[model samples]
Target: MDTMLTDIPGMATYLDDIIVMGSTERSFMGSTERSCQVLNRVLEYGFQLREEKCIFMHSTKYIGFISDKNGRRPDHANIEAIQNMPAPTDVPSLRSFMGLTSRCSTFLPGMHQARGPLNELLSKDKPW
Candidate 1:
């Protein structure tokens, strides 16, 4: 992968993911096109990207989050997982849920402000 992709500019790797980034559309397209040509060469050399795993344009899911032209957000898969989860049944379970929520909401906008009420629920004086 190293030698094959070395020719492509603006390519960054985060663990198993490759990030192609640019500050403007024109620049991004140029980088993307160049990367594509290089990737094709790599493909001919025997490596292949999974069809479903490939994403392009202004947004893509990386690790457990989604990054876009605008910025970043929680991964839809993670959100759906949380939404499908059964409701907490006890204090410990509730605390567990709160912990996950806090972690996932770190990059979320207005999290601190909107989470005030939820955060207050964990207070000693509050009823669960």
Candidate 2:
């Protein structure tokens, strides 16, 4: 990974995602070009590039967050999923949905407070 960093300057790695920061400088003589060159080298060495997953220039998604020079924030997909999830009809379904949304509870203000009802449903005495 250090080799990747040294080779792909301006490229930041967070787990599986690789963020390639862009520059206004000319492509032939800029950090962006150099970054691309390094990426090519890494590809030659057997690393496969998933073009569909790659984001150049603009902000990119990493982990469960969206990141850029400005900073990182929770990804909108997390919000959308929570907002669009169907109202739970049973304990099992509610638990499953809660498990998924819990991953981003930090972004959900007062999530601890909201868990009370869900917890009641999860109690062993509550059957599916």
Candidate 3:
């Protein structure tokens, strides 16, 4: 899929999903052109797209984030999930929570400092 769609500008593919982004704010014509190119390429390659799953918007959710002309940010559901996550009671659970938070660390400033105390609890010499 990557080989097939490699040169198309503003197009991204992950597994079976294809995302075409355009700056409708700049020029809706340019956006439409890109979308056409993507569709043509998909048809040329004999790949079928399910129209029911397609979304066309200036800002839309992609994978785990909300993306727009401004850029991507953690989706509200993702943030809420993190906030509602149970406090870790053991090393394994702590690691699990840490792993989840780390994925969103780009959206979280000063995460290292915030997690410093919790991080220390993972140290080998620390008593449980």
lDDT of each: 0.69, 0.69, 0.82
Q: How does candidate 3 fare on TM-score? A: 0.59
lDDT of 3 at 55: 73
What lDDT tens digits, residue by residue, belong to model 2 across residues 4-109?
A: 6555545566555556564433532365567568667667666777779754555667667776665567788877887888989888788878987787887778
Arrange candidates, best TM-score first.
3, 2, 1
Instruction: Judge candidate 1 at residue 73 and give its lDDT.
Output: 74
TM-score of each: 0.41, 0.51, 0.59
Instruction: Name the top TM-score candidate.
Output: 3
Better of 2 and 3 by lDDT: 3
RMSD of each: 7.8, 6.3, 4.2
Model 1, global lDDT? 0.69
Clash pairs, model 1 backbone: none
Give every collision pair in model 3. none
- lDDT per residue as tens, model 3, 1-128: 87778898666788888876656655433666766887899999999999898877889887788878876788999889889999888899999899889979988999979899989999987877
Better model by TM-score, 2 or 3? Answer: 3
Least lDDT summed over 10 consecutive residues: which range in candidate 1? 1-10
Stretches off by above 4 angstroms in model 3 are: 1-9, 25-46, 50-53, 110-127
